[model samples]
Target: MAALAWLLIPLFAAIGAGLWGSWANRNRKTAGDGIELAGYTRFREAMEKPDAVVEPEPHSGG
Candidate 1:
């Protein structure tokens, strides 16, 4: 019936979404602790560098 067909629309959508998500994430793996620690170390080293000094321009009186 038309009513049954409409009722199954969401069920089919949910099944399709689940299958797609599984396929999409099937090969994904995290870089884990070593990569994360390296990133933090690089960030700390960059922050310890001194900032550049800038000289102000002299004002000209009209």
Candidate 2:
């Protein structure tokens, strides 16, 4: 009986969370602008080699 009460805590929490999320998004509107308002500027590609060395000029065999 006590163990069942403890197990139902998470179930009740999930129900509450779902209700809150639904209510929060009930009257939401989409933004059509092409810009993001989060102001995040850092951008990086996946698995890009940052330590690569570049040769400014090619060696010519004389």
Q: Per-residue lDDT for 1-62 in model 1, tens only?
A: 99999989999999999999999989868778998899999999889888766888887866
How many clashing residue pairs appear in each of the predictions shown? Answer: 0, 0
| Model 2 stretches with alpha carbons more than 4 Å out | 28-62
lDDT of 2 by residue, 3-38 (tens): 999999999999999999999889767674434533
Instruction: Quote the lDDT for 40 in model 2.
Output: 28
TM-score of each: 0.42, 0.43
Q: Give the number of the best model, judged by lDDT.
A: 1
User: How good is model 1 by TM-score?
Assistant: 0.42
